[model samples]
Target: LVSYKRHLEIMGERNSYSKTDLDATFMRMKEDAMNNGQTKPGYNVQIATENQFITNYGIYWRPTDWGTMIPFLDSFRERYGTQSNEVVADSGYGNEANYAYMESNGIEAYVKYNMFHAETKRRYANNGFLVQNMYYNASEDYYVCPMGQHMERCGKQHSVSDLGYRSEVDVYRAVNCKGCPLRGMCYSSVIDRRSIKVNHRSDSFKKHARELLTSERGMMLRSSRPIEPEAVFGDIKFNHGFRRFRLKSNRKVRIEFGLVALAHNLRKYSAILSKRMMGRNHAYATI
Candidate 1:
């Protein structure tokens, strides 16, 4: 009991920690060697790229990428003393809090939210049971369910994320759903009335993001996102064979990765310089 208590004290708020590296978290490793999805001690690294160059980066202990976006951007701003005019990322980094941050900071967000692609499909849009598909009376602040029952806003539910971001969702309940035949199809609540939670602010953010992400410039930028960050990761993992970190602790790993980022940028510059030199040599030869 004493040994377990000591270990728990050392772990703190984290679920698991590596004894070898106190700062390292035991997270599920992406590359499961035996295909059993084994856990390994590692850190989640977030990076922003502009034209294939690493503009900013942050090391986070959080396994989920959604919560990392805000902190990563904050670090980028602190380092550069300015925020980027526009940001583009995958659905994993999209959330209400992240969108709000970008909006308040005046950064144009071309980020995709969860189920963004799925929501664009015909089935998703045509589904009557979906809260999004239901008729919403903005003037009265109420929703008309698929059964034509008025769902009035009852109250608000407030919750906080693990990262300490507070958000509120409005709860709407139908007047009576006891006799409705579609009650089973809509909600499975034990109560007679059907209730649903909706965050109008989040919905507004998502709507705006959809517009930005679907634009011509946004499409061009989105198409190149994979080539930017993913390509760099591929080069680091496959081409450069930098799969495992030689450093033990998070602070040491950060410094090690800093060198890696610098090296990648230097290699790109060298390649560009070599190409220019070759072009000059060809021009002189032709002359």
Candidate 2:
């Protein structure tokens, strides 16, 4: 029998793998063909598509989309010789590092974060009680709480991520709330004071991205972004029955996907040509 225990040590954070395909890492399968929420040995395939055509693709061992964006973009740059002017992605690709990278590379980001949707609800409206609802005076650098309390900057905090990215956050505290009537409603603190932390730079980046995402051009791109890659995924998975990889290693799997992508593009091209030909024939018959 194979040493399963030794394999587990080698695969930290990746719980399982196939004996035959050691390159495939265990990830939570979306379809879960067995309906048991079982982890399957698979590669997280990342693909970039434009105008419903696959522009670039990369097979990643990592399961999550968080840290995989940089490498995916790097692959795109390597293939195209330059980065795109704009990138439209869902909340999965929105983070500090990704935003910073895109900004530095002069790419307009139309991405959403985890709380973007939540903050749009009626409950999150400008009710004054919530920190998001509070109004800040940029000139004075102080926030006016719902109860008209001045929350001034108290201190600064520095946070470092696992990837060694450091972020500076400004801490703000309410001047005094010892006998405020809205204390319980505003916050649940026995000390009767409230504090809020803001990463100003990150917030600015998110604000810029949000503005771009809400613009007319951005909305058009956002609508088309889904149709581009999502349609390709549907065609590959449901239509072509490519739910699992037959190959064992990452390089081999990439080659397999390359063939699949090539076939898909050719099929699409043929369909377009056929439609044009039929249109011309119909015109000739009408004449």
Candidate 3:
């Protein structure tokens, strides 16, 4: 009983784990064969692919992609002796920590944050009430609200994550919204003033990431990102029937996935070679 309690302590916020396969964490599977959302014991598989070929793969106990990205990239660097020049991932992997890590490693982050989609919509884009839509003066370090109110920097704040990552934010507050025409639309504070907290570093990183994601080269990369890794996952899950790991524990599961990845690469290579040979035969026949 004491040992089971200790195991729970180690698991932390994770709700369920298989008693037999301790490494297999309980995660919501994406519509099983029955088309039902069922929580099942599984490992989060992270894969890096380029030109539709698997470059690196890692098995993580955590389900979310946010925390898995840094370690996955680290493993990729260790395996290849160099990190990728740029990374393109979906919003699930996008956060302040990942953005900061990519920046520190000198990799261009074309990742989207949680609010990226909402910000693209016409309502959110045109809404002057949102902090993002407000214009800020860089030199003076103050935001100009839609109602021509200056939100001055009031104080600084420090936030720490569960992983012990510390971020510094600047707090800004409008002088007054009393008797203002756009008071309710701009803010709903009882004090008649609007305040906002801005993580300047994170905001800067996201701005750069957003710019890269919208550029021609970035757009091309973004379009191809899903095809590269998703196709491999589709082949593994649907074609090869690898819905769940046959092994137990993190180490054994990693070994199982390593074999699967090897098979996938070999199959891709064979297909490419066969296509090239067929092309050669066709050319010879034409002559």
**By the TM-score metric, which is better: model 2 or model 3?**
3
Per-model tally of clashing residue pairs: 0, 0, 0
**Candidate 3: which pairs clash?**
none
lDDT by residue (tens digit), candidate 1, 1-287: 99999989988878889888988888897755667778888899888887788888778777789988988888988998998999999999889999999999999999999979999899999889999999999999999998898999999999998878899999999999988989888988899998889999999999999999989998999899999999988988889988888998778999999999999999988999999999999999999
> Candidate 2: misplaced stretches above 4 Å?
1-9, 12-20, 31-34
Candidate 1's displacement at residue 231, Å, is 0.5
Q: What does candidate 2's lDDT look like per residue over 1-287, in tens digits?
A: 26767887667655566677877887887756567776778899888888778889999888788778888899999998999998888999888999999999999898888777777788777566876678989899988888888999999999897667899989899978888988878888787679998888888888888789889998899888879889999999899898877777888999999998999888888999999999999999999
Ten contiguous residues with the weakest lDDT in model 1: 29-38
Preferred candidate (lDDT higher): 1 or 3: 1
Q: Deviation in angstroms for 41 in model 1?
A: 0.4
By lDDT: ranked, best first: 1, 3, 2
Which candidate's lDDT is highest?
A: 1
Largest TM-score belongs to which candidate? 1
RMSD of 1: 1.6
| Candidate lDDT values, in order | 0.90, 0.85, 0.88
Instruction: Tell me the spans in candidate 1 whose CA falls farther than 4 Å from its real position.
Output: 1-5
Task: Give the TM-score of each candidate.
Answer: 0.95, 0.90, 0.94
